[model samples]
Target: MTYLLICCRLLLGVVFLVAVTGKLRGPAAFTAFVSSVRRMRVLPAALARPAATAVVAAEATIVAAAAVPVHAAGVLAFATAAALLTALTAGIVTSLARGGQEPCRCFGTADTPLGARHVARNAALAAVAGTGLLAGLLAAPTGAGPLAAPVDPALAAVAAAGGAVAGALIVMLDDIVALARPHR
Candidate 1:
């Protein structure tokens, strides 16, 4: 269960970090992407850029908070992860309901098309965060409780690297598959 928490934390942190980085790497591009989604009339036309900027900032903050010690950072990371998953789920549902097939800006320009994959990943992450929250609540009480447990040095290093790789791979999975398939 502990390992599961760690894995989930790392994965969420990595995803947020990468997403922020991608958006920040090209703020204008992200804004354009947001505009593209908005063009579908999902979001109010006036709120598009501001909303996109806010999401970028939120992702940045979540990534930073998620990187700290478990006792302090873990709880916040769990909350952030849950929030992100919820947002993504909402976006997925809205897009499906609107009968649009716009590309998800989650992975920025590097991502392929948007579809069930975004929803699926968000669902899995939300489950992980929910489990972590439940486990934390069930544990014994203390001033610190246990959100900021000292991360194992070796484990932390591995988790960081693995998280980055996994996130990148997940984001690129569709592109890779498309490239692999033989032309009709």
Candidate 2:
């Protein structure tokens, strides 16, 4: 169970790190993200820049907090993740409901257009965060997850590989869904 929590932390941390890096990779990417936010219409055009900054800052904080192996940090990371995911889901829903057609600049560029899959992905991420928080809260004193020192190298390696795979799948969801669609 401790190892599971650590893996969750790793997976969640990697997800945020990737998002932050992809979104901020260059001026063009950031500009694309701002444009997507404006298309969503969740916030006023005047507020898009500050909102983008806030979003990136929040993601960075989640990555940093997730890297800490303390029980409290895990809880904080999960809580923040869940909240962030909820807001993202809402934005997606709003865009879809309003018939806004634009690519989701979620992982990187706006190559992949927004769809129900994006909403599903966000919901899945929120679920992961909720589960992580519950695990932290249920953990015993002195901690058993990442806080339980002396993690085996082999175990850690396996966990890391798993986290990497999970993160890859999430970031590639657009492609995955596209591939799964039936062709004429």
Candidate 3:
């Protein structure tokens, strides 16, 4: 159970942080992505920019808040993830119903367009968030007692850097893979 919570924390943290980084790095690209989806009628033109900005900002905020002590942070992280999942699920369902096909920028950019698979992935994350929230409520502690202690400062720094790198890679893997594909 404790291990599961830790996994959720790491996965959600890395995922959101990476997402925010990709979006932040390519704001124009993301805007273009959002606008393209809007044109496809997945989102309204009037709501595109604001919605895009809000989603990115919310992700950033979640990752940032989740970095702190577990009590409040866990709650915040859960809420943020739930909100994201709800939005993504609704968008995916609506688009599918309309026979719309648009890329999901949830992970920033992707080789494939948004579809039921992406929605399922988000739904899984939502489940993780729910589990974490429940765990936090039941167990007043963030991580297991001693094993979770901070490591040496240097090692901690290295780990943080690695997490960031891995997060970025994970978020961009689809786009990177797409670029590697042979042009038809």
Candidate 4:
């Protein structure tokens, strides 16, 4: 349970941090993200900028919350991440239903248009977040301090490494898929 919580926390933190950095890397990158939001048509064009800003803010918050070692904070962070992923999945589904082929600038500017793969990826992430939240709740310590039980240093390091690798793979999913696809 300790290792699971640690892995989940680091996985979510790394994912959110990479996402935030990709979007905010530069004015052009951010502009592209805003444009992608507008193209989704889930929200009115007037709200695109605000929506984009809110998304970035939420991702940033998740990263910060996950970084905290407190048991309560981990629970809250996982819950927030799950909610965010659910919302994102809904948006992607809605866009696809409307026959929108807008590029998903999810991890920065990319030409890959949104598709079922994006939905699947988001759903998987949401499930991971849900699992983490459940684990955190179930493993809550009885003491006043909500800190988790100390894990063996070696095991903790392994968990962190595994989480980081998973996060990186997720972040690069699009690129990996593109590379694997046979060129016309």
Off by over 4 Å in 1: 139-164, 179-182
Per-residue lDDT tens digits for candidate 1, residues 1-184, read 4444566567767778777777767767687568756754567878777777777777777777767644546667777677867876886778777886776677667445566766787787688678766665554234452444444668756766776677667656667778888999
lDDT for each candidate structure: 0.68, 0.84, 0.69, 0.89
Q: Model 3 residue 48 lDDT?
A: 78
Instruction: Sort all candidates by lDDT, best to worst.
Output: 4, 2, 3, 1
> What clash pairs does model 1 have?
70-147, 70-148, 71-147, 71-148, 71-149, 72-147, 72-148
TM-score on alpha carbons, each prediction = 0.79, 0.89, 0.73, 0.95
| Model 1, C-alpha of 133: deviation from truth (Å) | 2.9
Q: What lDDT is reached at residue 92 by model 3?
A: 80
What is the Å distance of residue 35 in model 3 from its true position? 1.3
Q: What is the TM-score of candidate 3?
A: 0.73
Those runs of model 4 whose alpha carbons end farther than 4 Å from true positions after fitting are 143-146
Q: Please give, for residues 1-184, the per-residue lDDT of candidate 3 as tens digits.
A: 4444455666678889877776777667687657755755757688877887888888887787667645667678877888887886787888878887776666655547776666767787788788877876676654554424334556555555654554456566566667888999
Q: Quick one: best lDDT, which candidate? A: 4
Residue pairs whose backbone atoms clash in candidate 3: none
Q: Name the 10 consecutive residues with the lowest summed lDDT in model 1.
A: 139-148
